[model samples]
Target: MQSDADGRLTPGGGTDALFWGSLFRDLDREGSFLQLQIRQIIVSAIENGRLPLGARMPSSRDLAAVLKVSRNTIVIAYEQLIDQNFLIARERTGYFVAGLPKHIGAAAREPGGATRDDGRWTSRFAHRPSTYRNIVKPLDWQAHPYPFIFGQFDPGLFPTNDWRESARAALSVPEINNWARDLIDGDDPALIEQLQLQVLPRRGIRARSDEIMITIGAQHALYLIAKLFITPTTRIGVEEPGYPDARNIFGLLTPNVVPLRVDSGGLVLGDEFENCSLVHVTASHQCPTAVVMPLARRHALLQAAQSHGIILIEDDYDGELMPEEGELPPLMSLDRGSSVLYVGSLSKALAPGLRLGYVVAPAPVIRELRALRRLMLRHPPLNNQRVAALFIGLGHYRSHLARVGSVLLERARILDRLLPQHLPHCTWSRGAGSTHYWVSCRPGTDTVKLAELARAQGVVIEPGDVFSIDEGSARHCFRLGFSSIRTERIEAGVERLGKVITQTG
Candidate 1:
């Protein structure tokens, strides 16, 4: 049985092409082969009785066209399925589902096996991490005409071919042997070497391999450090409007979380440092506000850290994405007393999903972090670490950064020019190399309302309320990120948001 040209099933009966298409809609493309994915889809369909025994399958060419995959890929998938007895090819016609054991072919028609309604589990939990106010962005942000959301990458800027080349190299037999085994609190040596030789130098920092540890991301590094250092009596200072995750991570351990002030020069140099045992600062580029800390302030902070015996956790998450003009050294690089723990991520300029980040510190600190990390998840996937090492070693990492930095610089300049014209009612701050604008509307204006209105107009924005520890302090502020939106769309998006703002006012 086969479908007619109109794609409708004929009286002879065949698996509908529409059904086949829908079956593979949610295929995981991250780490799987298309041929294997297709084969698995067919196998699942057969096992679920969607493709009953003797049910005809679509021709290779037709299915390939529908799936938008190469003809060779479809043929390979069909041939492999046939070899596995999940399918049987009928010469000159098409393939059909093969007869299988009763257990294999039978479908459990009862959707989602019965379950008892257990009593509430919230009371059993020690902490409720979910109740924390978090930055919310639509999962379908890409579908919007203008998505000014932070920390997301524009697909066009991703280095597809270069990354694929690196990934392929990592899959080689020797490379596989290097990363396949359970590392158990260890990271890929090659990646560590690459970070030491290639990455750290850009920030004017140097470290021995023993002083560095790989993390799933900068967030994971923060968690490990917090678990090891923070106690109920420990006084930790963070920026007033700063990275919420850092504050939350610290708050979980201690109630002495202090909200420090941030001005144009970055974290204000005040007596607040005297009360802190540790301070978490995003010195390279401030989290919600992309204001770079000046060199003078960097020195002051270091001095304060040394004087007060405070340990500074520097999150250089976007350090690599800074502009060349006024780039300042990371605190880790400038510290002579070893008071700074530096955390960096390749995910900011690269892809966030990669979750490759590292912490640079004194050897003793690294040892403790490694042990804590081992208890949590041992280490980040070795395969990804190896691939990132290959990417850096091959010089693709810097080149990719150069290209993305240039594009983002242009986008930032455009925002700078357009904001004054389109949003006169609001003020914004974007330092030299910042990728986002911290925008403030007129007094008494609620940006949460503005964001809701802007989103209805197909423009996505991030309300600044979540970044504030004081809750209501940032009610009139918002953040606009240009990394995810296309350059040409910037003007239109801003203009549309301007109209929404006027309407709201």
Candidate 2:
């Protein structure tokens, strides 16, 4: 078929080719299979009455020739549509549009109209979570030349083959039987077993299966912990430049959330611990700052918590990816009095979209959390749990971590070399084995503005002010993440960013 003057398809001197080629003009040929695309087009046309009920469809061969797809593609699409009751096939004749269900046909035929109502949604809402400040990253970060964004994956480093192998293994008959059922208030035993055997020992954590509960993510674990423990009057101490989500979660329940100071070590042990009943700390690597808590500091924080009779929530995010020299035992591993509740996730090393995390606490605490979780979500998807379990059990998890760690280490080293030459006016944190650097630009430098200008030049960096409760403290600071950027592009991207900073300053 060939297009006429009005951009509609016309048959090339043959009436056999259908003029319906206008429908497939905008087809997304690159996205999915041609067969599925054909089915979608036909279904949409029928539902919208463009192809009315009992309307004859183009023959598979003629339609395939017009669309430049294989004849088998159209045939399979037609057969599938016929099976689904969207189309009817005759032995010798072409397919016809099948009658749709009453609701579907009526809705498709009806014109959409806006609902009439007063604008009382704001008054009805009990809380306005949207007013809170959040750490926002560009949705198109991948399209940029330099995406120095934190907690995002490098597509190149993902273990595609290994993950696929595990996913395929999880789909087997026996594996499906194991994970297909609902487990109210319970996790996949295989995942729990894998966590106990292959995961927790690295952090010196040893816990019974009863003491562990799988969560949708670390945020979910924190939410459950907060719901179970936090009251409006409870005093919760959080690190000054700590995780924003944790701060926000606690703030939702209590007005007595206190900001604890952080130095070169981690959360400073002081009078702040004395007043707060609960404290949240990122022991392994502090968020935004990427500061690793020292052994002495970790010991001091634990002692202070004990002396003050305070419970501690330790979020050990990205700790598993720490270099051998930089690795420190988690607070949960050292707690003899059961004062620490440890939260860990595969998000930092694995993909964030997976949203798999676990909470390790006392048995009673875990039991309560499980009950609370059941009320909310029943349980994290069992299939994902099974796949993760298989991924770990097959030894792919450790190997993937090793490979990713090597790449990140190399990228970090590149940033280490490039930053001094390009941006000498800025000082940065020297947290070993960190995927990002917390940088303090020259005095009076507005990093938020700098970031905006830098983005115009294809460089992306995160401002540090959002991490701090007191915005003035981090006004001149920013964070540079090396995880998602390519190694060769690092030097040029940094050089460009330095020029922007200089010109803007």
Q: Rate the local accuracy (lDDT) of all candidates.
A: 0.87, 0.86
The residue-by-residue lDDT of candidate 2 on 390-495, one tens digit each, is 9999999999988988888888888889999999888888577678889999888888999999999999999888889988788799989888898889999999
The best candidate in terms of lDDT: 1
Clashing pairs counted in every model:
0, 0
- Report the C-alpha lDDT of model 1 over 1-505, residue by residue, as the tens digit: 3555744333223445567667788766564598998888888877787677777777788788778888998899999999999988867767777856766455354354356433466667778899988888899999999999988868999999999999999999999999999989999999999999989998898999999999988999899999999989999999989999999999999999999999987898788867899999988788888888998889989999998899999999778684657777789999999999999988987878989889999999999999998988888999999999999999999899889889988898888899999999888887767788899888788889888889999999998889998878998899999999999999999999999988888
- TM-scores, in order shown? 0.88, 0.90
Summing lDDT over every window of 10 consecutive residues in candidate 1, give the lowest-scoring window. Answer: 6-15
For model 1, the local distance difference test gives: 0.87
Cα RMSD for candidate 1? Answer: 4.2
